[model samples]
Target: MGESDLIHLDVVGLNPAIVKHEKQEKAEFSINRKCYSHLKKKTFATFVASKRISSLWHCCDEAFSDSLSIHRHVSNVHANEVDMLISAALDQMSNQSEADDSVQTSLNECQAKDASSWMPDISHLSEDKFSEGPGEVILYYRYCQIKEPRLIRDWQNELCSRLHLTGKVRVATEGINGTVGGTKTATSLYIKAMMAHPIFQVMQVEDFKTSDGGADCFPDLKVGVYKEIVPMGVDPDVISYKLAGTHLEPDEFHKEVQSLLNDGSSDSDTILLDCRNFYESKIGQFKNCLAPDIRKFSYFPDYVEKNLDLFRNKKVLMYCTGGIRCERGSAYLRSKNVCKEVYQLKGGIHKYLEKFPDGFYRGKLFVFDERYSISFNDDIISDCRYCGTPWDQYQLCSTDFCYQLVLSCTACRQKGLTACCPLCQVKGQTSSRSPTSGRVHKEECECTNSRPRIPTDTS
Candidate 1:
């Protein structure tokens, strides 16, 4: 590319005033060891200052391909100018009340050459110093009204791109739900940018459940307009947040669980219902909770209908992964007036684990990502489908066209864990089954049909 083409101002948004500032006499700008830490706080002043510094480096990148080369060029030729520009940016930022005092002090102490040198080698700061290591992950959702979902989706895409984040975000008239991952810095910038948006003005920054991981959690960024953040398959107008169940704090939930256990009433007045899909509950759940055996969330309403008698005169406590599902699920139940009272885990199991890790919930938390599952405790609740050993590690069936996932122990897998279920195994052995039609016939595994054979433990 030509120099002019490569140095296009679109990426820089560079103003003539910035060039004028660069021409001024050099002032020392120290690279503070703690500068990256302060950048993560999400204060407006810090965000703006970081954006400016990022822009300055972005412009510098346009002039040179290799960061080391740019560091050398700036150190030898434009060290003073770059320092002056940074000083000007820092000076402007220092006037803002939200800017960290340490940030300004660090910039002032940095020697231009040394500072330029360090900026190019930022990848080295990947240790414990940062709250989020290089590739951290997060799951956040907001149940709020959106006037323009398409516009919000477009804006979200640009924001995620700018921050080098990848994940899926679904926006609708009802709200938004997403689980995304990136380097700690990228995800931090994304949260800052998202909070600044007017559409998400009411969103509580603390509501986001940030976990340690990397961008590999999601394959790519996918933002789109959806009907609901958590699909309950109901009209949005029928239910609202005001009608949702009471939210119990983590400690409160723990206390309540203790009370329930103490009551020792076989005919309990309260119910702890797991609102997640059957597969999710198969791996992990709270002790003594009533986890429905439904295949998908869509069956939840029907489940409630069939079990209306169970909810009568009872205080029901419902929960899901991140709380969004329970938000609507509880609302739907409350609207029916079948239960005496309804409540849900404030932030769901994710938040509950934050306060009380390995307390009540057990086994691995099955996540819809490349990581598949995360452990809360060493307790393995489920047994290997093949060997019947105490194992919770789940994997897709070895059958190419079958999408069923089952718990297969290492020993079982080694012993030729082939089909998802016994029915599939029998079908796989027959030449009549086509590879494309390897999916087990749902009817064959249903209650009406013969139950799928559970492999007897051979070991």
Candidate 2:
């Protein structure tokens, strides 16, 4: 067997017998006997003409771009030896055909084992190609009901992995929310494939918020089923998607914000209430919007209930990173009849920014990805959390276990100021010196650690 064959077996857990049979079948199907004979006649001349390693490397590189470069290098540099190896492969195939009974039994046993246990590390196959191209980033969400979230998640995960794309996909009974990054071609193809699915047929390519293609948008793909895509900690019985607020298109939202600013209408009656977490709105928000001082989406329900009087007889505008949170949040507000009208940016801040750069919305939009913020202009609306200087760069807490991000200036960062708060700073410092104290406590303001438990009858 070739080293490539051995690698296939090791990496993807392909049964050796099955791999060998498949290879033999493909070779037989693709190579015509007459053409093979003609190739044999021309092989020696071609090999002799391409005597230099550089010439051989170029030929292999051009012809076998999908396979291992090293394998191509060896095959081309040692053409005579490759011919011998081909003869041996044919002989081995003949011998393997006679042991079909034994191989069949082994194949059945291998098939019984879990396929997901041995995920192939495809980085070796496509890392070089990925590094060569600018990446396309897509952010989208849907709020339709899903009967089989897990199945959808698995299918999306496999497809994205094979396509060498990276992003996060959340599947919930209510819908799907995802953001992916890949080569422009790959992302375009992915959108087509997703739209073809019966469940997502209503989805339009125009609905997706795209970034100018770049190489460093995301690191890897992660897709899974979740109780709630946005985790707003509300019972499904309490709110329905049908009752959500009206979706204002980018241009419509822009006009409304402009009107409010132009009129100096910053009072409760004509309010733009930001539905996203405080951290997100701290960095960027629509001008004159009331961003609640909350840490998580779950708290928004209560924040709204407590501030019910503010929404009464008011036109409340809501938004988040994407529109998932607003779907339920606005619905809840409408159910209470707390506002005269509730309007949400159709595709959230992402879509709005695309249409109106440096418009009503100002500063960098914070995203929950490696590329922390996407900027539409040079506006700096925030300052370093520690130094209070005009800086908006985000840094994850230096405490090994603390994952909270803080805006820190260069001087503060250089002085080891990486914690989100004083307690976290001390915890980070203490934990570093004593590894046993590495367990990180949840931030005081955080309501719950994991996704809020799906509301139950008992509790």
Candidate 3:
């Protein structure tokens, strides 16, 4: 056969079998042959050549050897004309195959399949529904080795910014810890993104503890790479989470706490230790738990050092706000070689409250945000620091320089007892009087000095 006849046979006969075989014989040979004939007549190469010689202004005289290069060229240079060019090319291909009935039928089937594939599957979008509210806040942390924390930090910053989230995110080689607030949709998206991340695939939707609040709960967005996701004032290299305490689920921890409560013997060997700071435990804590009086988390190491006798040969149960602190805090306690055993609440009070809101936990759960506390039950355990009335709400001391929080009730606050302590009140009054006071620096105060050297009995 002549070259033209050979080309026609190759396009019409041989190509069909190849295409049919590749499709696992799904398409009949007759249909495949018709498809190939249409494709060969309106080949992409012919389309590229036609475009090069057309009256349309081209960016450069360079010829592309492949479709990818041509696509790149068109996208980079004639971006504004991309839709027009695509429509023109589709019209040209359709016109070439309009005469053949079999070709038109095959094209219709293929176009239907292609269109279905392009149509987005909205099945997974239904999972995005959250509680009906203006917004929400998500608290989550993971302890895994991250070789490139800076990359993770950058990704977090970009993701949170795009979602219009406001909160603090800390990334380290160990992992990431954050509590972000945004619209329910945004928070839901953030959770999905975290679950999809390669480094954080181990995380589940349950790992994220959500509460009612929004972007307004925080002042602004802050994301950065840090030495430790949760600052414990100890190197993670030395006190690793791998050496941390055994994890107890909410139910398991509840049972354990119940057992502790039931045992009235003085020889009870287990101890419930609150790993959170004083300001946190001040409002709420597990019944009879030994809560440290340290102001900041960085002071925890020293507290453990000085109070080593308390945990000596005892089974210690440690817990914190969202379980991140207890991970490192338990590790630090374990490093001291004093405790016989250490166990932590798996998801902390956050998860426990979800499962058992009205269970053993009482009062409000202190959170680090504009919403100072969140409550599950209306149990008033703590009293106002000023009037001694039952109150659990916390507010920042009115003194600009003092960072202490005041547990003063609304009644006391109305009576101008907003300061954290007498020293803070005196300082605030003095600072407000002098225009040239220039902010006096006070290091030690009654509030700091009055903190118990050891745990006090709250029962």
Worst 10 residues of 2 by lDDT: 450-459
Tell me the TM-score of model 3.
Answer: 0.70
lDDT of 1 by residue, 242-358 (tens): 478867777778888778767878799999888997778777888778887676676788888888998999998888888888988998898889899788898888899988886
Q: What are the RMSDs of all candidates, in order?
A: 17.1, 19.9, 20.0
Model 2, global lDDT: 0.67
Per-residue alpha-carbon lDDT of candidate 2 for residues 313-378, written as tens digits (9 for 90 to 100): 998778877677888888899999868888888888888888788688877898877778888888
**Which candidate number has the best lDDT?**
3
Clash count list over all predictions: 7, 1, 0
On residues 3-78, what C-alpha lDDT tens digit does candidate 3 reach at each position?
2232235553354332321111222222344454444433443445456432122337775533356757765776
TM-score of 2: 0.67
What's the ranking of the predictions by TM-score, best on top?
3, 1, 2
lDDT of 2 at 40: 36
Tell me how far the alpha carbon of residue 180 in candidate 3 is from the true structure, in angstroms, after superposition: 0.3
lDDT of 2 at 139: 86
TM-score list, all predictions: 0.67, 0.67, 0.70
Best of the two (1, 3) by TM-score? 3
Off by over 4 Å in 2: 1-131, 212-216, 265-268, 444-459
Q: Global lDDT for candidate 1? A: 0.65
